[model samples]
Target chain A: MVSKRMRVAANVKRGPYATLTLQGEVIPSHPGQFYMLRGEWGISPLLGRPISILGEDLARSEIRFLVKAVGEGSRLLHALKPGETVQATGPLGNHFPLSGWDPQSPVVLVGGGVGVPPMAYLARRLSENGAGVIFCQGARTKEDLLLLDEIQETGVTPHIATDDGSAGEKGLVTGLLERELEYQPGAVFACGPEAMLRAVARLCRGKVPCYVSLEAAMGCGYGVCLSCVTRVKEAGKVVNQRVCKEGPVFEAEALPWL
Target chain B: MAVNLAVKVGTLLLKNPVMLASGCCGYALEMGEFFDLSLLGGYCLKGLCAGGSEGNPPPRLCETPGGLINSIGLQNIGIEEFLREKAPKLRRVNSVMVANFYGHSVEEYAAAAEKLQAEPCIAALEMNISCPNVKTGGIAFGTDPKLVHEVTAACRKATRKPLWVKLTPNVTDITETARAAEAGGADALSCINTYPAMAIDVEKRAFKINTRSGGLSGPAIKPLAVRAVHLVSKAVKIPVVGIGGISTWADAVEFMLAGAAAVQVGTALFSNPNAPLEILKGMEEYCIRHGFKDVADLVGAARDFERPDCNLPSAVIVTGEKVRK
Candidate 1:
């Protein structure tokens, strides 16, 4: 819950995206967890921008964030230099359920565009734990795919799909997801645009248990503001759950995605 | 000697003049992980109603130059659930706890107050008449002087605990409403809730907030809030609790000088969870440096000093040994 001004160890740009490695005390975070980051910019953009945890190296006491120059905040983040500092408050929100997972069964992961980074962290963690991992990555073209070599270095080759047919499969990522479901994965985890998450929820509906990470424009990346909420069904009644607190990760069946 | 930071609002006594504003601090338990709640003078809990409310739809907030507009619709777990879940945890915190209640009608406000009246942990009740998100009974009761009196009078009968009526800033003259609340037997007043405002995404051709409009809070509203507190405190005889965009200790001092007995921190908690405690420390330093033994000496210090002829003595009293003018 503390907001610290951490120096940037590295800001590496790869095509349209960038990765920022922050130097600070090690923050214990799991996959799908996020942090709210803001630059020294003035109050024009009053609140901090919510960024997912791409990876962390506790040995170096550094955390990495994979950012795309989508808006004012992200654009500022991408332009950060090596010595510049940024304010960060985190390890906020829920994380992916990896502890309860059975090691003998295969785990399927679905991610798209900016959503692909956490999957890389999840894949490496699951693989180190002696569980089989399969990753399905989606993008607009070959150049749009993120962290392929990094993910492949983890000893798992990703099943990639490109919409323009310039890469592995020539359709939506869900097309490859259907093929992966045939092997009967023990659990399915996904993070992406809402449409893709809905499709994945539909594909994994009754066949296997699934968890999806949701995104919302947040004022405070904590429980106080009540800004980031998703409608969830509990006991036949739909209630708005704070996405920053109760979840950024939720069971697919618990969500009313139609 | 240590500075006496304590202040009284009706029957409730605060350890200091800094309190966490409602809707920004949640139930206090969520923030307990960051700092000790006992460091604060008090904290006003989120607004509650007779029944559970789901609040407004998502895209509930947007940022302005120096503030935020939010239409959260007062989403809460109802009084029964709050009593069962949050009150027990709040009871353990060593600070004054004020329950903020709101409803769609006067009767509903009374009913909610009655439910919280028996809770030993709750030191007082604040009736929220300034919530801009609800469709009825919120800003409606706060705008008109008669409606303000009606709602306060109804709740006055419901609870024996001290009642503090929170006023809306979206009015022609806030003094009218302040006087009305005092006439209705309110023990204290909390002036200047968020102003009704909106933001739009011109590129997308849509409102930035889901509810089309929301309440504005932060540094942008501080000057306006100080003016409201000054006017309302002058118009009413009851104590005034100033709130609206108080982020720093200097801001809290400005409110006290303008006649607020205490001040509340709202949107600043989103950025810094320890704002109330920070303000409290700064206030103590300010009192010691100014050679004041008590923080209450600063309240209403600027009320009549601004007048051109205020320094002139109207009457001269002659004592036995010396003439004191």
Candidate 2:
């Protein structure tokens, strides 16, 4: 089938990147999946890059993304004006299984830099599910804090951190998470740089249930190119798992730390 | 009436010859939504090894004029996990799935094959003789015909499924290696794997891809791969599947005419997830248009007294000395 081609409803500059909210109707109950977007659409490059779903309003029929301009594709995506049409194939990949959480458990949402996008979607769902969600967001500077108000609407108490001490508490998001461990909730959900994930994995080691969304330059946003594989050690054996297939979100213990 | 683009190699058959090549197609089951993967003839998953391994560090890819160089280092989910997690999905696909296996030692190839041969989804197994030989101590299995025969024979003995030995073109007289593999009891052949290649960045004064070297593929290697298929087809009775730089249906047709039973799609998928389907359709239409009932009849029919027109150099070319030594 031809992939769903949509238009950019709005574009907002956040920190060092830009977030384009595409006009596509994905229900809030979607459990969150990614969209494969093309910057310069058509036959130029056959593969469409995968972008995470940040938040969507079912009534409004709009999906949001928090993206940083890091490469040629992102640069072109960021340069587009609002209402410009770009091709998007989504809500692709598997959705997070939120069955493990309970009402009494402390659900921690840890996000570092741009890895923070999907956490917004997860946090919204956890709040709706009565998981007592604690949203921890981290970025390099003050300008990187995104969707603070949107997060608050979900009844999540937002904790912030910056690399240069420009926001809530200086240091890493894991540092802020260390302080919030006092909540002693049920589980943790995080998305961010690989190094920060390793740090969070170490901090939550055997302490609580943790899940992290992984990022890789995907050729086919679905799971064709085994390029997005991440290693996980299970039962004393290591296995390479596709970040897009088995998960864009995997249990912290289940992750094969690269 | 619909044209039949599926390719049949011995008892094994493909819905279409445009298959997703290993390292290009992760695990067959999880890739369906992106491209309706069921449409392809078959899928060759990322090379699985006996022991779990972490591939080379990133910046694993760099683009060329009409192709790419990748040093993915055979990243796989290992045999056990694949069986438990990816097998069910693979079995569900209408197309074929050929598990691509590589090992540092002959024993590992046998063991990895043993693990996959049990799964009904696996229609065949393709052995990458190009993988570094950690045993006999540290040489690539593909570069030597002796090791090629040994690995292929060991794998063939371990499984009843069709055995395909994927020969690398980084050798002198590829036909000699094809003969060795046939002697080793391979059911068929896929010639050739991407030739060993590299790239350099003029500004940084350094290599573009990680590992400082990688496998070059896409349109650039099509001519060479076609030649390899044509030569190997004449030299051996076992079927040959052509792979390299095939981006369109015309390329697939060219390989078939040159004596390839089927074709594999790798770097091309990096650009279009649905390209395999398009190529498959195009092939079927081409056959019908030419008054042919099945394209299999076209294999190797293009042979003439004069050589085929190919853009690749008549001889293999190398950039510099090996540093990994």
Candidate 3:
């Protein structure tokens, strides 16, 4: 992967959320793949933070990222503005496998908090590929939900859940998931906090094929660092798989969530 | 005038002083997509053991101020797999290849080295002595001078290739281990591997890394590495290869000025895959600006500033028969 210094086309912030659109030569990316982003801030933070691809405009050659200002790095990213340059190395890691599915079957995409971006992108891709799509998102409150309009623009109505009952459902995103599974989706794709992913895995286990994107503190965002590893069962034995290399997307059954 | 960046460590000569440190660059092939691997002075593959390792559990890495901590446990494909799969491809690269090997015992280190002796692509053997000796009550082989000598001597006998022993900075006195490796007939020495360190998660009241403690590397360790290289280079006659938190050409120059014949780029590779090449370019620019004909002239340049005698006058005046007393 190449590290490029791209100019920020725009940095739009709303509430606790921000979206950065980078203007540079398009680095071909697929849904669920991520880039390691670092602001011009010096070495205090050290490593680049991994951000998932929100969407790509191939014609415009613009790549966007949805970031939440939860820490120093994200806060630095939040403060970024137009014309500022940022270092990004990507499109690293394995992506969500979109092929081999029956186009007639519905595919469910679930996300929580900042994890909603990639799912939104996946929703659009799945819909374009002729698969029926459903998007489920969860957040702490109404203002915390990310990319709702963008997700809906993909032509899929987003089922949202908020902790404070300020949004669609007054419960966890899994509550909406339970109701959606009644339709018997052909597959499920999810990304979010560990608790929500575990819940999604439990709900979809053995019933429908499920893929979940995981987040870990990453160093290289490549195979070499071995920093972003997750435990998974392979051939009846548990082994460590690199989240950046083997997956940020993995078959839910393959993971040892318990 | 062209700047000469070539540096020699024993019989092995490098096009430049910048190399990819062990454990940071995987087999050299993974990084080829980012930059040309041949641009580096050398490439030290990840630490290899007798058998393939799955490494530690999840959360193998975490970041600290100006640095990062990694507990990968030296995950690597077994020696046989490396030879069967990776060595042939690595041989085609123009850079010098140094295999960094570690083991839980002296015999295991020797056996692994013996297996690699026939591989023509491997220009040298870098013995990573940080692993704990299973037969020695779990004390790390690098912490004791005797164990360092034993491991070095055992591997020295197993391979005809130049042997470069990598010493850990977790020791009480780094010079002792440097001396021990030289006495063991080592051709060269790599000083200051990662410092043993740990971090905790306050929210969970637990360790951030799965293995609890790991090696700390990055800009934070550069000063400590320079000190180690300064002391160790003075204690031994063999060329010293400096490693530990070298991110830029200035950092590499500091190591050379402190007495390192060459330097290795480690954690910085994660931040920028082009670090080694960037450092090499900066080194060339630095040599040209300073009017130095050769980069080797920077090695051990600080040694002249050492004050060995406290009683010596700072300055002596001589004015024909009126010299200051």
Candidate 4:
């Protein structure tokens, strides 16, 4: 069952989809927990799709989603009128634990394309905990860049990357962070393309502890179905882990990224 | 309501049959806290190797209309550490635990199986033979029946537990590889692993998976799984496991009717955790609704020997564009 008190915050677009913001009382979501907003149905009617929990203004009772319109479900979300009602399910999935994170550590934040959305929230959370955050994100082009205003508002310096020289560095997001590593960050938090994350995982191999958020197209966003498994390094075995229930977030170097 | 869903895979029974396929669930234990492991059919841990796999670079996964493509190159933590940390808690799992093993060579498979066999908690082992032998010529041992035979034999000798050889749909004859596994004394068979496929992010001008190629699984791959399961079931003596894009109980029933002894939900589980529970309930209801006392009656129920011999007629003819019947 879902709460009916949800309110629309914003309906905007970037690429194939429109980003939707919802204002609802905090159902209590961790960094990676997601909310399913759509017509009154499960997956059918292809209703509004699930989006990564970008950030939560727990005090204000609002949450944000960086959605890409890859299909009919997402496309329909663009038509959601502000102030209109929606049926949303969760605050679901696992969240990154800030429990033992050392606040004084120089946290290197790495994200790619829309993956940058969650990292922004992570930076805000880490900053609140007293950690210094350095953010990095990449897109195929400058137009693909998302939420620059909200990010800039956080006051954490951001390093940008695009496939072309449309904005920031010309290469990939990995390049921007590699050069910045000279300054020596103590920890790294990343989410984005696995290839890029794998590269970052290798770079963080011996340098710092890396925590990465993997993206798996999820269905239940719970633990039962084994659909969203990502491989992780557990002692000697590269174990397949579920991104939905286990983590959208994990130790970067700890995951078995090829 | 949270449904209680669990099933057994051969002798190694599970709480439910909704397991984490090889590439879907990373490590066996990553999601332990999110759900009650006791409720799952059983989950196969990530693939493994003797050495650390850096895997291929960049675009690792790409999304298709109904599924996704991934070429993570069987990136593993090397078998040694997995035993030290994962084995202990895994053995204590409320449900069955299966370790999915992969290797770049026959010896690697042998070593991984032998080592994993020693773990008491591991209920069974799944062999993904179609994976590219990264250390060798970068090809799958399953593409040829001979390699599949050799690989299965080596792995069989290395373990005493129930072993399931996962077959690839890339081969001309999936049954040929399945027979090879049977000849090699494999306890069972899981067909098919994702088919060889690729997707391009048109905007980025890049392949969907970082490897420029990857295995495809999801609803789109469901039809292929049904075909493979039918062929292998008819050819082999051991139980046949069906997998593809199983997202619904109705889909599971279809696989069972096509001769899958049990079905493994891959891409469907990614979409919904409660899917397996729903499927289990559906199977039971189907048994009751069909007036069958046990669920086994559903296996291969759709087989029609009258269809111009044993070969299944094309559900939809592409050439003439008509059903054969």
Candidate 5:
């Protein structure tokens, strides 16, 4: 819950994507938990951008984020250099649960574009815990694929899909999930574009338990400003849940998908 | 030298002039994770009604240059849930709690006020008349002076707690509603709600928010808010609570100098959850630097400078001592 200035350790850029590392008294974060990061100090862009935890090294006191220069707030973050300061407020929101998992079944992890960071972090945690892991990622092209070396460093080679057939497969990540579902994966966890997650949720509907991390344009990432709410069906009633508070992650079945 | 940061809005005394605007800080519980709630002068809870609302659809916010547009549609957990769930936790927070509520009609407003009246944790009631009137085919209650007076009087009769009417800035003359609220037995007036505004995404060829238009708040609206406070404070005899894009201590001081008895920080809390306490500290430093023994003395201080024959006070003397007293 601490909000303070943390010095940037490095901004590793790969095309338009960046893996930003910050060194400071970092807040310990769980997989799927995020930090509200604002590059520099000003009111031009009023609120902090919610960035998911790409990696955390408590030993080094460093936190990492995978950022895409899509918007003003993120462009500010992507432009940071080593020794620059960032206003960080976190380990905010609920994290992906690692309990009650069956050790024998393969844990299928799926990600798309900037949404891959949390899945990468989750993959590392699950593998370290001695759980069977399978990773699937999709992007528009080979160059658009983010954090490939980082995911490979986790000792799990990703089953990649590119839109233009420049990588592993030439289809959406859901196509890979459809193939993996035959192996009876214990659980499906995904973070990606809405269309891909929706397809993943559909593919694993009755066969396997599925969890999807959500995203929205947020004002305050701390539950006050109700800017990032998505509809969830609870107790047979549809209600809005704040992505920053109730979750950036939810059981896919809880969501009201059309 | 010591400085007194306390100020009174009607009979409701705040330890300082720093309060979190309604619908901005939620119940102040989330903010407590970053800082202690007792550090604030007071906070207006999110707007509530009887049955609660689902609010608008997805994409409720849009960011402009130095400002934010939100169409949250007053999503709240309703009075029953607030009283049963939030109120008990808030009772332990030690800072003043103001219940902000709204309704579509006069009777609904009165009923909502009465519902919150029995809660011992709530010190004051702020009536949000910016809601559309269902009886009048969606015309806003605060937009019309008559409706403002009617609704304020109805709510005033419903509760004996200190009543503060939050005036909307969509009206042609904000002071008209301010005076109406005062005449209708409002103890104080919260001047200037968010200005009606909109934003569109060119790429998507769609509106930024689900609701095509929303209310704008942030530094962009500060100057407009200051002018509203200045006019409304002069037009009404009761205390005026300034709110609109106040992000810093200097902004709060500017509101006070323009004749606001107290000021509320809205969108600023989104950027910095520690803003209220920070602004409070900066205000204390400002009082010490300006040689004013009391922060309340700064209210309407700028207005005194406009007088022709008045004897100007020295730097050591506190100006506008008689403005509020």
Candidate 6:
């Protein structure tokens, strides 16, 4: 619920993407949660862009975001110089489920492009909790495979894929996921493009429990605006749930993916 | 010098003139996590209808330059659920709570109002006749003067609570509806709901919002809203509560001068959750600077101006005359 101006500690660019490190009195947050980040002042781009909580260090009060320079809002975030501040309002939406998870069975995490950041943090937490973790990431090219070193630091080697045959597996990351599902992983956690998520949901439908983090164009990142609603089936009836409020995370079985 | 921020919308007395608009403020309780709800003069909770509504589909919002078009379609958990889950929590917050309700038909509107009238936490009721997102009920009930009067009268008979009719900007003359509502016994009027607007993604070659068109709100519509508030205020004896792209205290003051007794902050809360309080502080400072004893004194403060005749040179009329029928 905290929204304040945090100084840009660093901006590490990887081609069209950038991992922004911000330092301040960070809001307490978990993996898969996000902040609505924006410039200190502007009305042209009205709403704050919702950026996932890629990483955090509560002791140092530092937070990180994986931003893609795709539009006006993210471009503004990527172009920020160190020492400049951006308004960060966050710890919003539900986080990845961690409790009651068995450490004996392996946990598989799927991330694509900018979606890799949250999974990296999730992998670290699961590994720390004595769980065997497998991280899979996909990108357009070898250069787009983000946070290889970071994911490795969590003591898990990310199974990588590139669309152009420029990386580990020369195909979609879902191919890697399909291969791993054979081993009967305990759970599948994912965050990525809708098409990728749909594939993950389909692959894990009856085999293992699956969870996904969703994104939408939001007005107010709170419940009020109702801008970020997505359809989810509950009690045999389909209903709209706000991605910012009801969840950015939901069980795969509930989503009616086409 | 002490300044009184309190203002009256008919019989309903708000601590200040700044309240969050309906639809923009949710149920008025979700924001308690960010700040104290009591800081606002009042907040009109999201529009509720009979049996509740599921709202519109995803891709519900599209951002335009300095504005946003939303087609939330009046989603709610139903009045029974609100009373069961949210109302108990709402009772704890010390602020004016305005329950905004709508219906697919006039009887539905009355039933929803009557259902909400028993809640002690609700200080007033804002009947939404102007939501542009829905297909049948909302804006359809707002565009015509006869329908506006009919619906207002139905709701007026349903509840003794201070009734405010939220007018739609989609109408040709906003004043016509304003007069009709007043004649039908509306205690107050909320001038100008979001303008019916649309946007398209040129790359995708598709409508940005699933509803195709949505209600546009934000700073882009503020001027048009201010003009509507002025016209509506003059047309009706009831107080006008201005709503549109009011983001700052100066904007609120502008509305007051244009004839609104109170103002609502809607889209600005998306960008800055603290906008209402900041606008409240700014309004207080503005009053202090102007040596006004009360915020109510600022209402309708703008003086009438003489129309200046335009005397353009003959050379400027060349294309105008040439294109004549």
- Cα lDDT of candidate 1 equals 0.88
CAPRI tier of model 6: medium
Q: In Å, what is the interface RMSD of model 3?
A: 1.1
**lDDT (0-100) at residue A33 of candidate 4?**
60
Tens digits of lDDT, candidate 4, A41-122 = 3434322355777787778888777777656666566667788766666676666666555555577888886677778777
What lDDT would candidate 6 get against the real structure? Answer: 0.88
| Model 2 C-alpha lDDT per residue in residues B1-325, reported as the tens digit of each score | 5566666887787766777777776775545755666777788888887655577666666666556676667666688888887787667677778888877678878888888788887889988785431222123888788988888899888999999998888888888889999999998998778767788989799887668777777788888888889888888889998888777899989999988998888777655556677788788888888887877778877843335585533443222111222
Question: For candidate 1, what is the DockQ-based docking class?
Answer: medium
Per-residue lDDT of model 6, residues B1-325, tens digit only: 8899999888888899999999888888777877899888899998887688888777888889989888888888888888888999989787889998998889899999999998889889999999998888889999999999999999999999999999998987888888899998899999889999999999999999898999899999999998889888777788999998999899999999989999999999887888888899999999999999899999999874434595533332131112222
lDDT (Cα, 0-100) at A11 in candidate 1:
94
lDDT value for model 2:
0.75
Worst 10 residues of 4 chain B by lDDT: B1-10
**Model 5 over residues B180-221: C-alpha lDDT tens digits?**
889999999987788889899999999888878888899999
DockQ-based class of model 2: acceptable
CA-based DockQ, model 6 = 0.74
Task: Return whichever of 4 and 5 wins on TM-score.
Answer: 5
| Share of native interface contacts recovered by each model | 0.62, 0.31, 0.77, 0.09, 0.75, 0.78
Model 5 CAPRI quality: medium
Those runs of model 3 whose alpha carbons end farther than 4 Å from true positions after fitting are: B131-139, B303-325
Candidate 1 regions with alpha-carbon error over 4 angstroms: A99-102, B303-325
Q: Is candidate 2 or candidate 4 better by lDDT?
A: 2
Provide the overall lDDT of each model, using Cα atoms, as 2-decimal numbers.
0.88, 0.75, 0.86, 0.71, 0.87, 0.88
Per-residue lDDT value at A55 in model 5: 89
